[model samples]
Target: MKFYNRETELEALSKMRDLSFKEHSQMTVLTGRRRIGKTSLILESCKGTDTVYLFVNRGNEAALCKSFAETIVREFDIFVPEETSFARLFTFLMELGERKKYNLIIDEFQEFFYINKVVYSQIQDIWDRYRKKTNVNLIISGSVYTLMNRIFKEYKEPLYGRADSLMKLSPFSTNVIKDILKDYKSDYSNDDLLALYTFTGGVPKYIELFMNQGATDIETMVDFMIRSESPFLSEGNILLIQEFGRKYGNYFSILTAIANGKNTIPEIEEALGDTSVTGHLKRLEEDYELIKKKRPIFAKEGTQTVRYEISDMFLRFWFRYFIKYNDLIESQNLPLLADIIKKDYPTYSGLTLEMYFRQKMMESHEFRNIGSWWEGKKSTEQNEIDIVGIYADDKRALVGEVKRQRKNFKPELFNAKVEAIRKKALFKYEIETKCLTLDDM
Candidate 1:
């Protein structure tokens, strides 16, 4: 459960902090989804330095500022008015920056939108007025992806273009996951690795929870996740409700359909019994960033062979099992729900295995483009290639067939599929065929 694989991010933050000390004030914005370890990374970077960490909780602004002032007094041994507003506290901190250097970290910076929506404008004014003379390293972290994007990226927002640096933290990579497993269970099997990837998707919080409960294998992980009073049961809903709000019904339906294997627009519409989901789909992809629109590697942007997929592995699993079996969960049938997941986990993990290899190939940095290739529609299952990676040099490509069991991968049929796609390929390049199974992990 120890921190793993944030060396690059930590180095970047260190450079920014050093720059803040050498130059004037600098603003760094850290953004990621909930439980991706933003706060941990920030605290680790600010260790051994003078830091004032302010956690934004939903409450009256004046009361919140009073608590913040107490923290400043305890940490920095300086005093200001206890009843000062957030605006005044921020201004006072900036004035202090003019005299000395310190790191000012505001966790959950987006919560200010709920406490007092105008706080952004006020901070913007204070930052612009004092930036040239202050020597503070301002670090802000937000878990609400959509709100953080709007606050910094939108041109019309008050804090737009104010950040000197923006860092978006992603989940731990495949190698880091392997290291974690090796530390926890040195004799782990491929199934253990796949189950960890399938469930946690390298999210630090979830992995820590499983490791703390000694759930080192597939069955134990499923039991721990589905037991009564398990936090995993309600995690997805809690993560998305704030972003989707009152209109979550349609979004949930669309996501569940995709998770259940209806990826195309027509199939999803048919499954939902609705025709107008274009706007919702766009928002899900572009605004919320929960889903991604994927096309074949060489396909044009206007190609009709587009598919929608949940970008987060954890959410995909949650929608597939937890949301789909809500009735069983609500009826206090945790045993039944766990049994159902255990029954279908093989097939589910098979699909996730394909995703795992694709991600691994992406992290290798050997390919310029990576995606699945299908000759015909979804009905023609034989014409699909599990993975296709165009080499970064542009002269060679990798076509792979992925399966859960090594016995299920037929080299003859897979080679024939590769040849058929090669003939239809745009360029006359060399194709290397590969058979991937859990052994590759």
Candidate 2:
């Protein structure tokens, strides 16, 4: 598929390149989760330019330096002495930048932690010595969020405060996905569109995989992704293990519980056999950003009522089926796994539809705040509202429930819940109630 969005990011990167030449060497740090296209964006920005690209793979430090030295020699077309470490190789590049201006892209930069822990300090020393004299636009990209944050965002780290620009890449928006779907299949229905969003979550790499195999429809996409050779089966396992480190077991258990609908603190802990998960959950939310903590709309700051949801759409779907049915996966029963997901998809997609409308509302930029409201202690099926939006000026509110079909909606019961929230919290504003289905998308 063609590059859909990121016009603004490309513009900013180009502007930063100009600024780097005007001032001195400018360091740019780009971070996002795995498969979010950080590397693709960087490479796209350097088309037809003098660029040296280095991938920091997990291996011997000296061997990696030799590889990078070869790349530098190939890109610059000059004879150079061999270097044994990144520190020496990088110092050579910085000195070379004094005369030749080029783009220096280092991808998977966090892997330096495994190759050589002192690489950060070495680069910091080299950068400080040559920054004012060098003219290179140095861009470093990483996928591991925690280690990357520690390397640049924390105060004590050597690279802290060194970046001229820091950008966290986000997923493609709803409209971008719709346009891409139309580009591939002009006759696509809202169900196919929702399935694409539900499965890929607008992440470029996953979407590319699906589209490459001609998996434009729901059944085809499910078949391609759930097979034995498919990458989706092990995606969550590999990526999160890299992020959470050695104590990944506990984190995985907590995440799996949340994905399976054990949302609340107590419920997750119980599902994990009473494992102590409070600290783990906090890290997952505030640090890893894999899960989001949600409270009811108009809820107080000190409210004890809280719920957790996996923030990544693809991972949410993966954990719900791929992790939950490890027995089927390990036995290579992929047909059964696909069947199970097909059986459960209707109920599952209904929940995803709620998120679709919530995202649609957010895209409009019309709401000051958007969330669902539920009663505190006496909460049950009757008191839950799937979506609530307070208008930007606080004059109107949008309250609604989400369902896959119109016949499944209960208008009278929903109005009763709307009245309850109106009297309890939103009494001051005019409210609009809606039942968002697939057609709304």
Candidate 3:
């Protein structure tokens, strides 16, 4: 695939490449979910440069040693003994870097924990010994969240503060989807793009799969994406398993419960099994990077009215449609799913639009900060503000709700919601109010 926009990251990589020749080793740690094109980004940036890519696996120490030796010998055409260990192989690369400038990439780096628990310390030793004498740019990439952070970000880790650059590769933006549609000569309308964005959230791999058939209508998309035997059908299960292992079953239950409209802690626990969900929720938020705890809009720091929501657009969509109807989908009844989708889609999608707004708020420069708002009452008296953006410099804030159906924008609904927001806003910063929509903004 010809690479799309990563101009900022590319520039950052180039700067790191230039800096690699300085006294210290120039290292970058790239982290993201699986198949968000982290490797693609690395490949594109390393083009025409002397670069070596090594993919680490979760095998035993001896197997990993052999793989490293083979990778070094095969990629560099260097003669080496069969029984060489990774320590020796990496040490040799460090010496080579003393003579020539090169880029070294270790993909799926988190597997090193399983392969050799001491590998990070060993690398740190080599780096400290030879960093000033070498001109190598090292990039460590991983899909596992906790392991990667422990190796590089944790204060006590051997490689702590070692990275000169850290890039967390995220899903592509909605604009990228529009660009893809335009490039493919698909004349999809704005609403179609919004629906696609709601479902895929700019994940390049998922978008490309659904875009293959040259149809962009939401109804057609639901048919193609949720149908039996579709590659995307059970993708959520695979994705979560890859990230969280067997514990993914619990996480899946939590996400599915949220998708079914269970938001509070007690509600989620009841829906999943019991209060044991507390541990699973913590891991989902802290380790897997899949969910977030949401407090009411204007709540103070440490305010207690909190709810949980899935943080990824594609996962939310998957749980809402595919996982919720797992039985029907598995029994080869896609038309039945299509029917359920037809009935529930508007409601489900209206929820997704709120997420869409969050993505836009993250990327937009118009707002200084953005978040959601709700009342202090956890279950009872809960009024929601879908999108809340603050413009402190302007003494103004933008409060808006997102709906899938096309209808006239109403100010009365805004007034009712604003009162609830005002009650919560008292504890935090304040600003004037404005309403917005997809077109209005």
Candidate 4:
């Protein structure tokens, strides 16, 4: 469960801190989904430095400020009024920055929207007044994507355009996951790697949970997820209710439909028994970023051949199993639910293996564009390519057929599909075909 990767992010943060020390003041905004290790990264970066870490929770502003003042006093050995307001405490910090340099970290900063929404304006005023004369490296982290975007990216918001650097953290890569597995179970199999990728998708928190429980393989990980008190049972709902709000039922239906293999608009509408989901789909893709609209490689933007996919791997798995069988979970039939997952995991993990190789190719930085290619009017007749990666100059491409087991990959059929795509002449380049399986990871 030790920290892995993030060398680039740590180096960027170090540069930001050095800049704050040279120039009077600088503000950095860190954003990511819940449990992506934002707090860990920030704390690791600020180690061995004078830092005042304030965790913003939902409460009365005066009460929260009292707790923050206590932290400042304990950390810096300076006494401020316990009853002071946040605006006053922040102004005091800015004043202190005039005499010394330090890092100020505010975790879950978007909670201020619930406690006192005016706090953003108060900090804005204080920051503008003292930024030029203070030597404070201010860092704020938020998990609420919509609220953070509004607070920092929307021009009308008080704190808009105030940040000198913005960092969006992503999940660990395939190699990092391998490194983590090697650290714990050096003699791991390809199935272990695929199960980890299928379940955790490189999210550090979930991986750490599985590793802590000694769930190093597929069956144990599935059991750990579907047990009576497992956090995985409710994690997707907990992470998304705030984002989707009251109309979450419709969003959930759409997502579940996609996860269940109804990716096209018409198919989803038919599955939902409702046709008025265009706005919801747009919001899911553009606003919430939970789903994405994908087209075939080399397809036009206006092409009607589009598919919707859940952007998070874990959410896809959750909706596919837990949400799809909520009745089993609600009735306390966790063992039955785990059985269902075990029965269906092979088919489900086949698709996830395709995604794993696509991610691996992307992380290699060897492709200009990467996506799937399909051509047919009907689902039964569609000739689909698992992966297509075009080089920078467009003269070379990697067309891959991915399968869970190498034995399942039929070379003749794969070559026929590649030939069909070549007939289209989508890219007048040399296409290299390969079969990617779990062993490639």
Instruction: Go through the candidates in order and give each one's C-alpha lDDT.
Output: 0.92, 0.90, 0.77, 0.90
lDDT of 3 at 432: 53
Candidate 1, superposed: residue stretches over 4 Å from native: none
lDDT of 1 by residue, 1-441 (tens): 677889999999999899888898999999999989999999999999999999999889988998999999999898777664798899999999989899999999999999999999999999999998988999999998999999999999999999999999999899998899889999999999999999999999999999999999999999999888899999998899998989999999999999999999999999998667889999999999999987877889988889999999999999998999999999999999999999999999989999999999999999998998886556375688889998999999999988988898888788778877888873577888888999998
Give candidate 3's root-mean-square deviation (CA, Å).
2.9
TM-score of every candidate: 0.98, 0.98, 0.89, 0.98
- Candidate 2 lDDT over 1-441, as tens digits, reads 677688989998998888777788999999998998888899899887789999999999888888888888888889767888889889889989999888999999999998898999999999999999989999999999999999999999999999999999988889998888888889999999999999988899998898888888889989999989999999998789999888998988888999888899889989989878999998999999999978899888778889999999999998898988999999999999999998888899998988888888898999999999998744698999999999999999999899999989999999999999999999999999888888888
Q: Candidate 1: give the clashing pairs.
A: none
RMSD of each: 1.1, 1.0, 2.9, 1.2
Q: What tens-digit string does per-residue lDDT give for candidate 3 at 270-292?
A: 88667568788878888777889
Which residue runs of candidate 3 sit more than 4 Å off their true CA positions?
22-24, 60-74, 378-383, 406-410, 419-441
Q: Which ten residues in a row have the lowest lDDT in candidate 3?
A: 432-441
User: How many angstroms is residue 362 displaced in model 4 relative to the true structure, after the best TM-score fit?
Assistant: 0.4
**Residue 78: error of model 2 in Å?**
0.9
Residue-wise lDDT of candidate 4 within 297-340, one digit each (tens)? 89899889888889899999999999999999999998999898
- Candidate 2 global CA lDDT score: 0.90
CA lDDT, candidate 3, residue 170: 85
After the best TM-score superposition of candidate 2, give how far the Cα of residue 337 lies from its true spot, in angstroms.
0.7
